[model samples]
Target: MLQILGAAHGAGRLDPDEIDERQNAVLRAKFVDELPEQIDDLPEGAALAAELSRQAAAASGTGTGGTARSGPAPAGRDLAPAWKGPGGEILPAHQGTGPERTRVDIMSGSEVHVEPGTPRVLSYALMGGSEIYLGDVLAPGVQVVVETYAMWAGNEIYVPPGVKIVDETINIMAGNEIGRHARGDGSNGVLVLRGFSLMAGNEVKLDPDWRPGPAQLGR
Candidate 1:
């Protein structure tokens, strides 16, 4: 059941809220019969095959529901405060400031390629992950704000050589790491990272073997 929810999220078929809603329903079910009936209630095309499979299993009385697990709770919607701007105004879900700047909100997963001349970015990740690729060159004082909340959520920013990074992020049971290859000589530009992370991690690295593919380049 959880696998179906994960797949739907990965395919962009379900947003975080819907995922959480269905997950809680599944977790709270008291019988195998309740599982398949709830599966039938999912949005169209979200889990057709899973619905059929679970229905068959329930008909066979394979197992009951609500079994206890011995680990941390499954990843779900976070209760962190809404992301706010520097002035303390709540930022919208998704928006772009200009042609060269963007605000990204990630719940399941996403990837972004930073184009040339782009100056700033606001990124928020909850219950999922995101990757930002900074191209080979950057203007001076480029800034990227990344906030990740909840367990298993993370962000990875790839930087090119010769570019320096200044990180100013608050972390609670979370942290950021800069890879050895990403250490810069301060000759290209300074990339400032700002934001907070809770029970998550952020990484800055220079992946020498990685390059944007055609799809990412086109975007």
Candidate 2:
């Protein structure tokens, strides 16, 4: 009678339809990891791709309408400001550490050439009391170039934190009137307390990415 019971219990181990839920789950996960991901090299947007091609020319300040030259402005007009606001100060800040950490590192290199060079000119309108900050370290391994066009005399500008104003020689071929905009020296922390612009022309380059931090740790 004991042998009979033992034989009946052992029959369960011989069944071929038994399934292991844990083993199936592991196999599914491995299959997912082995699958290939699709990446699009050339997207459907022609506008953005054109900008990347002429990045080198823009940064070097050597492309069409890229230079700023000397000028004798009308009365009551002043040139670019070389300082910041009365109480302005440069601040240093970032997001987080480890996974949340971000860095702007632009792998310096020449981009594709702009054949027949039709460079886009930007127009921005900045009030006299407003300030501007140029940030470059949010993306990691990147550099940025900013440009502006004049509408009315937008002077008395103020530079904010994370801004490095650089007056580059990228516009050697641009006309004198077109070249007399603003300037910066490519420093780490700079303040532009004065400038002139129109509307919507305030553009900035992001070689990597950009991340803005808080002013200070609460009082």
Candidate 3:
């Protein structure tokens, strides 16, 4: 069980708080029946969880081969239905107004160039870094959510001129810095940033030199 949790954490599938909570539950279990039957937070961990339950039941002499104990599910196992987008893609927990583009970086670096059609951008960084560059001319009401997790992770958002940036990100033992930029009077829709940095850093600034051509801006 510890191995499974470790693997999930190392793969950036589970956050530090989740691993800590699950490990505490495992350590406090006095009997095999008290062990967790499933990792409810992990959408794809059902099979492994079931196998662990079956093995635990067999080892405790509560059931024979090919048979496992059956009872009501443990508390906290009931999760709300996941949010899905128009195309059936699962969205983040705090998705605001829905995002046209979602960029994720895990243990690596990535760059995302926002175009005209995309009004909302969701950028996630886990144990890695991500740079988001806003187009020169942004549509009205453009919003970007930059989330960074794990230690040493960072996210950078480059804002061009004539755009008002609204910072709404929460930082926990993390740095959230907004560099000086040419302020706009909200003519172009305000760029609202919303997300949290957990033991990480997120920087929002103006960069005037990065001008990527249309060919470089892939969907």
Candidate 4:
């Protein structure tokens, strides 16, 4: 699947950013059924389908396309933390390289203000919760990716109004509740949120009513 996307990108059918997005989707895909959507509208998607069929035949040892086995999914990828602050400490707002800054909470909750200009974030919460406030300095047309995991916990993500949002979270006895609408202005960036929620819930809000404290103002 990635090979086909690479070919499309080399032929100018996909740009660097789109290629990156599709590649990420491919890596994050959990099943054969989910694979088709990632390349559905791409230029060489048909080839991907054929390739997948061939692989399916090989896997089944039947050399025929029948009912494919739906086995247990592989374990989730271990992403690095998103906040580097000490445990239980409120993380101040500051510019960062997205999710490369790790945030891990075992049994406590913390707050964070992510400065704009980053394109990606990876986070995890276990038996705890987090509140992330996005900064307002993002560039137009930039696409930001925020992936997270919540087990027996929840997350509140505050996004600015001008950006577009896509929710791709997969839930297991849990789900996400989005409280904002996509912006009509095409000049804003895109927020791509993907991850898992197990016995937890995640929230995405626009211009959330909550305010930062004096210590949480700036880094």
RMSD of each: 18.7, 29.9, 18.5, 18.8
Decreasing lDDT order of the candidates: 4, 3, 1, 2
| Residue-wise C-alpha lDDT for candidate 1, range 62-167, written one tens digit per residue | 6333233212221231111112244643222221243454444456767777765455666667767667777533422333334334344777877754456777
Model 2 TM-score (2 dp): 0.19
lDDT for model 1, please. Answer: 0.53
- The pairs that clash in candidate 3 are none
State the lDDT of candidate 3 residue by residue for 76-103, as single tens digits.
Answer: 3312111123454323222235337776
For model 1 the TM-score comes to: 0.45
| Each prediction's whole-model lDDT (CA) | 0.53, 0.25, 0.55, 0.58
lDDT of 2 by residue, 3-99 (tens): 1112322454312122122212221222211111110122322333344323423444466344432233222321112222234432332222322
- Residue ranges of candidate 2 with Cα displaced over 4 Å: 1-121, 126-131, 135-142, 155-164, 168-219
Runs off by more than 4 Å, candidate 4: 1-99, 181-186, 208-219
Cα lDDT tens digits, model 4, 37-129, are: 566677678766655545555555556556665332333311111111345232333333554446777777788776656656667889887
- The residue-level lDDT of candidate 3 at 191 comes to 68
lDDT for 144 (candidate 1): 37
**lDDT at 60 for candidate 3?**
55
Off by over 4 Å in 3: 1-99, 136-151, 210-219
Superposition error at 146 for model 2 (Å): 2.0
lDDT of 3: 0.55
**Model 1, C-alpha of 45: deviation from truth (Å):** 48
Query: 3 or 4, which is superior by lDDT?
Result: 4
